[model samples]
Target: MTQFEALFDGRSFAAILFDMDGTLLSSIEAAERVWTRWAAQFGIDARTFLHGIHGQRAVDSVRQLNIPGVDPVAEAHAITLAEIEDVEGVHPIPGAREFVSTLPEGRWAIVTSAPRALAVRRLAAAGLKPPSVFITAEDIPRGKPDPACYQLAARQLGWTADDCVVFEDAAAGIRAGEAAGAPVVVITATHQRPMDTRHPTYVDYNALGATIRPDGRLQIRSQSTRKI
Candidate 1:
């Protein structure tokens, strides 16, 4: 009787969409390892560098670092390759298997900024195989915060954006869902900053124990709880 099970006792959602990196799989450690190695190559403090781009895309993160003479695209590519090679400590999120297993096959897909090859490698490392309809960075012209990924996912799932519930841990991902006209259930797995909880389409679930209802609502049963 975990808190999430209690909270999600009676709810129904049409379809569920998940974000791969932090929400469904714990890839932060792998990401940190790769990024730190890349930063060290430039004599930068890995910890400090990681903090500056914690929730951003690899390319965006590289740009922000403003490394003296390094090309952002090249740096991002290098980091991506390193991450693919060193995907240790990556595993499925708690309750991920059970939650995903309960959902109808083909009713959900992973939408992530990771390119196809890397995404596959990470999921494999996590011991989780995604369904057939995943939408990776390679599948979309734009990634999170652009709405393209979510929209494409919804389309592939044969559902309208309004009928899908997006699970994400990043602000950019939430915004992407909102932009795509989908309801977003945010899992606080990584970002520590306070999120804007006022938006009608946004809701936060305590990652300690949370579940997506069949109806698409997120239920989090903890001592302190409130509905969005």
Candidate 2:
């Protein structure tokens, strides 16, 4: 077992980039419903299908699954529509709204592989306001593990990738953050087993022991750890 603290010691992270689904929002069950239904249609194990899709772009995941004669485009569209309409299990992660609201304008943004409309719905359902500038899969040239989204997010915030800290909860997101030249902070909300990244991982935002300092900087004190 290894332990590490995140970049939350009032460091000079000018901005924070967040991934939506498993990071800021606990929308796993909602996502699972979509994937599981697809799995059944393809005669695949639900567990394996779900395991393979986390932190992935819907289109990419659909294409990768390549379920025999399944049309990736049609499959991706169906799943996305289903997810946008279903809010039964969608909610913000603990401490997510509190911590995020404390950030200064332009200091934080959401960069997710979900479509803009779906992202908006999830945020509204969770009672969290979306930042002025939100980046969605539709806006990016490529998905996570490609770094295009994170890099574009940094650009939108008028900052360099190195000036931000990225909060993510999936393998692909971690790789994207690292590739974008930002320090990655992994939230262990999605990955049941040990995360594959060597970056600092925390259970959730509440684990940051986060508080707003008088100087408008974040003060953090937490003993968060991850097995890997």
Q: How many pairs in model 1 have backbone atoms within 3 A of each other, for residues 3 or more apart or on separate chains, i.e. clashes? A: 5
Instruction: Write candidate 1's Cα lDDT for 73-105 as tens digits.
Output: 877887788888998898877767766765667
Supply candidate 1's per-residue lDDT for 84. 88
Per-residue lDDT tens digits for candidate 2, residues 1-228, read 334433444465667899998899888888888788877877887886677687878989888876778888788888889988887888888888888877777778899988888889988988889897799989977888899898888899888887888889888888899999998888886566875667787777775654555765444456555443
Best by lDDT: 2
Worst 10 residues of 1 by lDDT: 199-208
Each candidate's TM vs. the true structure? 0.78, 0.88
- Local distance difference test, candidate 2: 0.80
Off by over 4 Å in 1: 1-12, 52-56, 191-228
* Model number with the top TM-score: 2
What's the count of clashing pairs in each model shown? 5, 0
